[model samples]
Target: MSNVKDTTKANNQLIYAKRNMWTGILFGFGIVAFIDEAVFHQLLHWHHFYDKSTTEIGLVSDGLFHAFSFFATIGSSFLLADLHRRHAFWLKRWIGGIFLGAGVFQLYDGIIQHKLMRLHQIRYHVDVFPYDLVWNITAVIMIVIGIVLLYRTQS
Candidate 1:
């Protein structure tokens, strides 16, 4: 009946909205990663921000990997979102877990690799920096927010 049709339409709209939101989030993060690695590191030569010389190259490589992963994940999310619209509990759980893991890894890397070990410098140079704390806090906030979103989005 009309009630059944209306319910189906509403469900379809909800699925579309959820898929679009995730797609936007993934693409936004991917773009940020690309800018950090490609534009900032490769093109601008902004200090690799790491202590170990060898690991400097690895940092850039990791950035690239992150960019590619983000894109791939986004693509997969869209496909899975479409296919699992009606039965998305498992899919949501898996994606949420992945995001949680990635966020934790980034948090650890930022603290130990970047801050504790003093492998990487914050600014492009050793000169006095005004907004260093801001940058660091922002990174921490992003990691926390990512984890929270992942946890909340999971069924």
Candidate 2:
């Protein structure tokens, strides 16, 4: 019974060590979503969330996307706050997690939304292949960096 308890405690400690990375991933995802909306959708006016729909619908879609991302950011903040309270926060792992999350989000948008769903491309009136190529490749690179950082994080 003591051995079993020891194993359980060890497992919990291991999980705690990786918690920052996971939380950072969540924060990264939300931040990327916000940046996407700000840059592509609003700032550049390259494309809306759903270009196939009416303009008003497209605006609404963007709003919903913002709301979702906002909620994700908020949720991650709560978890991070708890970790901070416990003095378990590890900044490096958290940042790596953010990178992982952002990379994953970008990759998904580039692959699934851009290629698979046939949604709006990166930008209109542009040579899409280069944009797609660059976008996915960059995302992969970011993900690799994130993986390396998280793996090398001190326990």
Candidate 3:
């Protein structure tokens, strides 16, 4: 009976942690996307979400991307609230998820979007090497930090 109870408890903990982490990941991704879109795309006029075509098309793409970010943010917030209400939210695990998500998003934008898809550059007409290096390295660092945090939580 004791062993069975312990196993059930452990399983519940695992499930809670997983949920918290995933919620945090969504939050992080949405926040970063919002920042990138607002600062670089909108504020700085650096580039759009999709810059391969006319400005009008780019604006439309940006609007769609903004909508995605908004939905992700709201969805994650609701999830987090539910976890909190259930008293199952794990702060450390959630933090780890946040870092992981942000890093993953940034890396994807830097490599796949900026380079592979030719969607947009960090900046235009200027030397892009420094920008690319900084962007990629920062993303790697964030990912490492997130992984370390998540690993530690497992113990």
Q: How many residue pairs clash in each candidate?
A: 5, 2, 0
The Cα RMSD of model 2 versus the native structure comes to 5.3
**TM values, all candidates:** 0.46, 0.87, 0.90
What is the full ranking by TM-score, best candidate first?
Answer: 3, 2, 1
> Alpha-carbon error at 48 in model 1, in Å?
3.4
Ranked by TM-score, the better of candidates 2 and 3 is: 3
Model 1 over residues 50-109: C-alpha lDDT tens digits? 436676575766565656756755775675566455543233434444443344444544
lDDT of each: 0.53, 0.85, 0.89
Q: Write the per-residue lDDT of candidate 3 for residues 1-155, one digit (tens) a residue.
A: 99986676456557798887899889889988999999999999999999999999999999999998999999999999898776667788889999999999999999999999999999999999999999999888988888998998883
TM-score attained by model 2 = 0.87
The window of 10 residues in a row where model 1 has the poorest summed lDDT is 87-96
Compared with the true structure, what per-residue lDDT tens digits does model 2 show for residues 18-135? 7788789999999999999989899998888877778899899899988978988998999898877666677778888998999999999999988789677888887889988988
Q: Model 2, residue 108: displacement in angstroms?
A: 0.4
Once model 2 is optimally superposed onto the true structure by TM-score, how far is the C-alpha of residue 88 displaced, in angstroms? 0.3
Candidate 2 vs candidate 3: the lDDT winner is 3
Q: Pairing residues by index, what is the TM-score of model 3?
A: 0.90
**Over the full model, what C-alpha lDDT does candidate 3 score relative to the true structure?**
0.89
